[model samples]
Target: MNKFLLVLLFSTAMLQAQTVVEPDSTGVVKSNDSLVVQKTIMRDTLKPFKRYKAEGVSAVVGEYVILDSDIDKAYVEMQSQGMSIEDITRCQLMGKLMEDKLYAHQAKQDSIMVPDAEINGMIDQQLQYMISELGSEEKVAAYYRKDNIADLRKDLFEANKSIKLASLMQQKVIEKVEVTPEEVRTFFFSIPEDERPVFSAEIEIAQIVVDPKITKQAIDEVKARLNAIRADIIDNGTSFSTKAVLYSKDPGSNSKGGLYTGVKRDSPWAKEFKDQAFSLLEGEISEPFETEFGWHLLYVEKIRGQEVDVRHILLFPEVSQKSIDEAQKKIEDLKKQIEAGEITFAEAARKNSDDKETRNNGGQLVNPISFDTRFDLTKMDPTLSQQVYNLKEGEVSEVFTDRDRTGKSSLKILTVTKKYDEHQADYSKDYERIKKLALREKQIKVINKWQNEKIKDTYISINQDYQDCDFAGDWLKK
Candidate 1:
């Protein structure tokens, strides 16, 4: 299966595949059941032979129960993600399911509240992606075995909410776990010499980017359009949400009528947009304002304490080919200057690069995933990795045009500043990497301890067939 299909299947797994047990009077559970069974079963098995019941209770954790069919579902889920299942056993899958439910049950006991808006927004995005890929809402509903899209959405909401709760619970358990430099040193030396990890060949690169300039005419035209939209809402009583659906350029929110709930002053929104949103009274619309995302008109629907419910329509000014050509020429000139020794690459980047994140730092690109200056050559972004693989240290590459995720185009030139050959891990040279690994180990230990304690206090049961399997946790304690 393709990546998107895998995502769709994983996201909707519980909706189409989950079978909650519903036991009948004869001690057998019915198939195609939807009710959640919470009662505990205490009988021991006479034989360890596998007896596959389509909907029999495989395990129960607190108020949640896993059906026998869920093991099959788990297999399908793993296969969809391109995982090798040859060595994976049914008991292992059941243990994972029980762990998830235990976390979710404990999350509720601790009063962890997942906002309805957050869950609803995720469901909307998932449905939109499925529909866009599968062609229509009808097709999406049928693909997931639902009678209608509404039913699919209902299932998605419950499953997604549970997922968020479990995830939050895990975060809460390990949020405060941290490792010191001494712990990192101890952990690094504890590994066997032969078993120590080999560090991959890595490169540190920097870039100089020049963006096409937007003319005043284009900016005014965009603002004029937004102003017209604002007038229609005020004079003709046109719905702001309807306008957002029809005209908003923000793909993240356009399908949802450009609505964003629970927005706060500290949210990672554009400062200009947030300022305008907070300044407006409920049911008031703000004048058009400019941000890095271009012009936007914001409407405040309501305010709840520190949070606000808002809707917006975003529009970007069009850039002409002439401007793009000028940007290309400008970057080419900078590259030529560096090559001729007229100016150093770092000096040019600091003075001329338009990329805000790197310009002030001498255009040195930081790896977002590792929060470090180095990127493993094999794991770097395909386009960037190809561009810098042949360039020697301090040698500048030919000018190239790059487009961001938003499809905004710019001119850029790259140069590798440093490179490291593959070698065995060194305690002094790889302290950052070692520290990260040590911290992860500490977090895992913390989570394991938390799980053990919770399992002892919670109600849990396992089927006779799985009782013989060696589980990581003591699931059959009671």
Candidate 2:
């Protein structure tokens, strides 16, 4: 028989064996033997299970039915993420899907609520990512085998929501899992001497930035321009969205008519922006206000209890070329003073650096990914790596022009404060990294135990064909 016909025959076989058995007061099913207990739990869990009328149902995990096609789709997703799937097998995919379904099902049972707005935001981000990767909305829909972008979004929303639930459930299981210092040492020493990981060549860098001054006249001009646009919208009934599209300097929202949704008090927005947004009633626009990025006029589109949706137009004051030249000269002169031993580099940075994030910390740059002072040379940003490639410890680089994320230009000079050559990891020197590894291992064990226990309590039935595959968990048991 063909695979499809075989699946149909199995589905019919399963339908012919429906039986319901209730558990006792101790939450254990009464049965003749161990095998019978397992069978009874399966039947009890599937009391109201809907019978599949067609083929291709690979397994049933609690309330979810995994289909044969899901494995293929998963493989496609892994490929899109640049993962090598040559060593992976269909059985592995089936196990992973079962785990996700189990987590998602248990999350709902535990009343782990994922907000609709959060899921919708994730869907929007995913849609944008897919569109960017595939060239357009039309291409994304076609790639996903959907008739239109709406259909694609519907699918993505459901998929992303389930994935988020699974992730949250897993996090809850391991949130408190930790390892002490003793455990960290034990974990590191447990590895054989020859098997210890090698430390990569790394450097710790610091910098000083000087921002060009924006004159008061320039600031007033920007505020006046924003006020004029706001007045036109309120007085002449011109579209605020049209004005945002034409004038807003914030690239993130300008193209979308400055629309932002799900703005809560705790959301990571500028204090000024949120203050202005929350102060307005629906359809009310605010006076021009200043934020670190620029001046903005906020229009409250809607208020949904704790969350508000707002639209805005941003305008930043212009910096004159003379001001830019002056900033560059200031940084250059500071470099000379530091080189001549008149003022220490760190002292100069602490006193004069315009980069607020590092100025208070004496301009010391921390690697964001590692949250440490050292950065691995191979993994560092190409531009920065080249700048510091030849510099020795305590040597400062020539002043260079840099642009912030907002495209604001600044002059910067970097100093390599420390350097490390590749070497075997030392216990004391690598303690923090080793501690992280130990903690992660502890979390993994906790999650594995949780999964094993949940698998036993939850209802899961694998297809006879896939039952022979060796799985990490006792999934064959109820």
Candidate 3:
């Protein structure tokens, strides 16, 4: 995934707000001003009439503007996504919107603009990711009610630009803040052992996967079938999407009429899928081509710059029952041999295990979080998590099936490589983690100091209503 996309997807919680309200009543408000006030509450509701007298209608108007627009929208969206809106308040929304607007304005004022090259690079990254997620541009466009992928690309690019700019600004701030080793160590020592993160025991695993080969005859047969389908599509004037929904074997995309979304050029499916899709002109249908998944019949619906909306029907060659039985039998035989002391598990895994990721590393599983060959019981996959909890060190597990990161299922045998019981964090073991925490604290202090001193020097004015609203930062005071 592109770093910007990752931030956009996960970093919404980090946006901070700085709001300023009006101090006194009745002044002419300017349309060009960045901040505006609207009344949300009745004037009679406020206590201490003198304070209300000072602030007047601007305070009420400011509150109303924030509530009606930003707060209400956020609440509705959150509720639509199954979140409770009861806890959300207008104040929170106002704070967030104000912060967002402030940062956006600052970026523009500072000339923090992404160049065309950067935009193109980001667009490519986003497109590939969307392709992988939605399986193809055709599916994406269909989902978004777009006529083609080009339209989808334009929308995605615009949506992602705001995300990218915000990230760029945040990165500039974070990069300048450094954490020293000594500070890291000291911070680690300060945290209570009970609160320290427990290191998970993980494993390093590899696999040497051998997909059941599809013969040339099978490929030709599938291709011939696809060609016939394409001919029918042309002659009958049937939509490619209708055909894909009926015939495509890619279950993930087939249900969505063979459209995919958020695809970028550098994604996993980008190279092979994109090359084939982009090669064809609009409304052109192609003969079957082989990809890792299977053989595919593709139809190009539209193209936008480097992005293409293409529908595809996939057909994976059937693996013979005999072949599957043979593979299983071989695994069973290997297990027997290991049990009978013919060879060590590590040696057997190195020689015979099909898993490339874990085989070379003696078939030990690694923790995804720590990226280490140690297992923390809590961090293990739920099924594996339960099974591993009961096993002792050096125990071999029953042959079981599991899916890889890409959701491809495979049969495997897990061995207990290492185990660490729950334990308190210590300076000796957790110094680096602690140091990072301390450094971040120090960085925040630096940022706060800068904000306090610099905000006064900058041009800032809050509407009269918000003048009394307490803000954590000194920008309000200015």
Best by TM-score: 2
Tens-place lDDT per residue, model 3, 227-264, is: 88888988999888888888887765687677654333
- Tens-digit lDDT string for candidate 1 (33-103): 12111111112223221333455788888887777655654453344334455555665566667777887
Give candidates' CA RMSD values in order.
11.4, 13.3, 11.9
TM-score of each: 0.63, 0.67, 0.64
Our tally of clashes for model 2 stands at 0
Off by over 4 Å in 2: 1-195, 234-237, 262-266, 301-309, 427-432, 461-478
For candidate 3, give the lDDT: 0.53
Better of 1 and 2 by lDDT: 1
Per-residue lDDT of model 2, residues 1-478, tens digit only: 3333343333332212111122232222232110111121122111211221233778888887777655655555444445455555666656666777788889999999888766665444445445545655678677656698768666656665666677678778867888888999998888768767677899999999998999998999998898899889989999998998898987767887887655666555678888987888899999989988778899999897877878899888999888988998999999999999999889999999988889888899989656789999989998899889999999999998887656777889999999999887789998987786667667656766888888888888888867776665678883
Task: For model 2, give the RMSD to the true fold.
Answer: 13.3
